[model samples]
Target chain A: MRELIAIEYAKLKKFHALKIIFAVYMLTVPGWMYFMNFFFQMEPGMKALFTSDNPFDFPHIWSYITYSASFFNVLLAVIIVVVTTNDFQYKTMRQNIIDGMSKQKVILSKFILVFFLSTIATLYTGLVGLVIGLIESTSYDWYQNIHLIVLYFIQTLGYFSFAFLFAIIVKRPAIAIVSFILYFPVETIIGKIMNADAYQVFPLKVFADLTPIPFFKSIVVSMKDQGGKTPWILDTNIQIILSLIYVLLFFLLSYYLLKKKDL
Target chain B: MQQEIVLEVKNLVKNFKKVQAVKSINLNLHKGEVLGLLGPNGSGKTTTLAMLLGILHPTSGSFSWFNNGTKDENRKRIGSLLETPNFYPYLNAYDNLKVVGIIKNVANLQERIDSVLELVDLKERGKRPFRTYSLGMKQRLAVASALLSDPEVLVLDEPTNGLDPQGIAEMRQLIIDIAKEGKTIILASHILAEVQVICSHIVILREGEMVYNGSMNSLLNQEQAFRLSATNMEQLEQALHAISGISITERTETDLLVTCSEKIDGSSINKRLVEQGIYLSELHAYQKNLETIFLEKLTQ
Candidate 1:
């Protein structure tokens, strides 16, 4: 497994597009966060939700980072698609098998790569959050916000693994990215048409709900002012569990398809 | 001495949707033998190699490598090149081989890569990315990768598919050198002359069936053909028709080709034709080479 990962790492080192996507993600996440913070500070009306407190403070800082990082999952997912589809496009997957790696090893290599990418994204998010929190938080509290890091990791894993599955099912990178983009709208439309809470557990919805946009607090503040009830779904535990299950399902299906499909 | 069997394939078949690409191929490769898989396009040669390498699943039948049924176990001892040269297009030739070395688990990585690069004559261009390479360079890099592990068996499919004449000669020489090292080689090619030059044992596939499989010497040792033509083509035909031991296989405006029993000689045919009052314009005996045999089998 280490050797496989080493080989995968070597392949990625020369893969310029993946490097570009990763660099953009790493740069964009923090840059976007700073810009959003500046905008919120400029607008007094938007600033009333947290009562003039630094949103980058410990407890609230987790939400700030997680919410911003969640959107970049699409970028990370595109990275996954690019790396996975490259092997198929270049016929390197078949060559790997011919060179003596097992089919399981080939697929596992990609899975490991996705996990590695997600882990890196998580660490980068937490590091950025730590820097922002240290500069802004009046009360230093690290342990209180660590669970957000865990949730962020799971969310990234869920998205990247889903991308891996999409690459396997749809071998072309362009089609896979397009399909991945359309997944949410398509699933949401279908879920609303079905109009059953049961169908809310579908893949895209579960991942979206995992580390949700942290605007529920702001919505609740305005709703309280207007005497409206919170329509937010607050079950993080259920979302985490379901997201993990989807991650496992995506991985197993990718493995099955890679092993069963002709290279 | 009995050679150890390195590979044994029995009743191997592959079907793609409605087309049966490879239908029930069976053959054996012994240690240190250069085995050639010969066939034209769509004859299932590539499919057979793919199935044996575990790239394509067999619809039915089974194959064993080094007497081991487990693919992983057997595959670790084999190095294969299937179809086109497949490496990361953006990676240089040296890095591409490094990837293969890691997968195949070769020791002394730098030295092995260098040796293979030298062998394929791509040492100077090893730093160039695969996408920048010409077709021959790509093929040379593939050969370098295949030899990276110094594996016990080498399975190559059309290793010379897109090379110029000189590149083909170099690639053929490389295979011959590897074979001389006593590695078991299974080569698939549509070039009959190339196979004749490099292979000791041959399996000929026609329309997914193994029409011929045996020693190269045995397949090439066909009955010698005698060509004869006379002033009177009609008399020549009548005289050859009256002959019991000989059968005329081909006849054109100029000559009649006859295959006779071992007891007959070219002089006897000539003497008989003379006695029958048919003056001969030409007469010669010739043995069939691999090309003639291949053409015969393909037509059959």
Candidate 2:
């Protein structure tokens, strides 16, 4: 098992796409924080700008980071796609099999690497949120923040797991990236204009709803302020359950595709 | 033969989609023998080797190594190099071999790596990255990887491809030396001369079918006729025609080529010619080489 992990680590380290995505994430996270604080003045306690009592509130941080870096997550997903597709493209998996690695081990290695990268990205974003929250407010209970951190990590895994499945099925990086990018707007537009309740079950909706943000509370606030009808049918518990189901289904599907593949 | 069988393939068959790459290949290798898998491109040489190594799943057949079943335990006793040498380009030769050692579960891996590198004559270049090495060096490193576990049987597919003439000769000698140490080797190659020089047994595949499988010398001796040259012109032909055992093929102004039905040597032919009052300046006998036999089998 230790040797297997070492081999997977070596493979991930050698992948160029993973390296570039990591560099991009490192640069973008700090840069985005600086821009929001200095130029846009979106920092808390600014009278002219919108401010919350605790911008580090789970929902607030989720919305800020997810909205700010959602495009970057898409880019990271593209990197994952490229990394996953290369084993098939270059026939390196065949060589790995010849070298005595089992099919299950090969697929598990890639999956573990994907989870590792997602965990790293999640922790980075959470750290950035913690730093910005500290600058905005000096006093807060760090112990209570564990739940938010756990939720954020789980959400990140959800997105990356879906991307992993996409990559495994398509076996082509460009197609997977395009499909994931187009997924968001397609679901949003269909949800609002067509009044489709089925969008609630879509993976993107589940990810957004489970992202530690009280989206329903925000919607209710907006509705009360504007004198409009309340939106949404199911509660948060159902959404979380659905997301977990999606995660389970996607993982099994990915495993099935990998096991049946000729490579 | 019971104690000698090191590797056995019984009616092996492999198909890719609608095309059958290997068709009912039956082969048996003895200990301390080099079996040459001779065929042209796309004749399923590599495919057969892959199946024997268990890297490929045969459509219908069974093969065993040293009477052990086709499992990881059996695979541990066999080492193979199918297709090209594939390793991490960024890693040095030593590191690459170390990785292979770990995969093959070798104990005292560092010492084994050192020994393999020295065996392949790459001890000095072991620290250099594999990408920086020449094609011949890379192939040698691959050989070193295959030899790391001191496997009982080594299956190499075109091990000398891209190698220079000197490298080819060195590799041939190395294989022969390894076989002398009681290791069975199955070499797949298209180089007829190398096969003839190194292989004790030959298996010829043509269009996914085994056309010939036997001892190399016996295969060569299977040819019915031999070419004979003589200095006497028509007298040699007239003398040869009179004898029912000899058949004259070509009669030139200065030479007469004849074929004998039985296995006859130069001295017997010369004695017969002299007894018939047909004096000859020179008498040369011809035997079939591997190239001719391969071509004949392939064409048939």
Query: Best candidate, lDDT-wise?
Result: 1
Model 1, range B39-79, lDDT digits (tens) per residue?
88899988888888888889999999988884675776888
lDDT of 2 by residue, A61-145 (tens): 5456655655466666676677776666655566566656666666677667667777887888877777776666455554444
What TM-score does each of the candidates earn?
0.94, 0.83
Minimum summed lDDT over a 10-residue window in model 1 chain A is located at A47-56
lDDT of 2 at A34: 65
Compared with the true structure, what per-residue lDDT tens digits does model 1 show for residues A138-246?
A: 8798568579788889988888899999999999989999998898789888987884676668877777766665656667777889987654553888888888898
Q: Global lDDT of each model?
A: 0.85, 0.74
Shares of reference contacts reproduced by the candidates, in order, are 0.78, 0.14
The DockQ of predicted model 1 stands at 0.75
What CAPRI-style quality would you assign to candidate 1? medium
Quote the positional error of residue B84 for candidate 2 in Å: 2.2
Alpha-carbon shift of residue A88 in model 2 (angstroms): 3.5
| CA displacement after TM-score superposition, residue B13 of candidate 2 (Å) | 2.9
Docking class of 2: acceptable
Which prediction has the highest DockQ against the true structure?
A: 1
**After aligning candidate 2 to the native by TM-score, how far in Å is the CA of B296 from where it should be?**
1.9
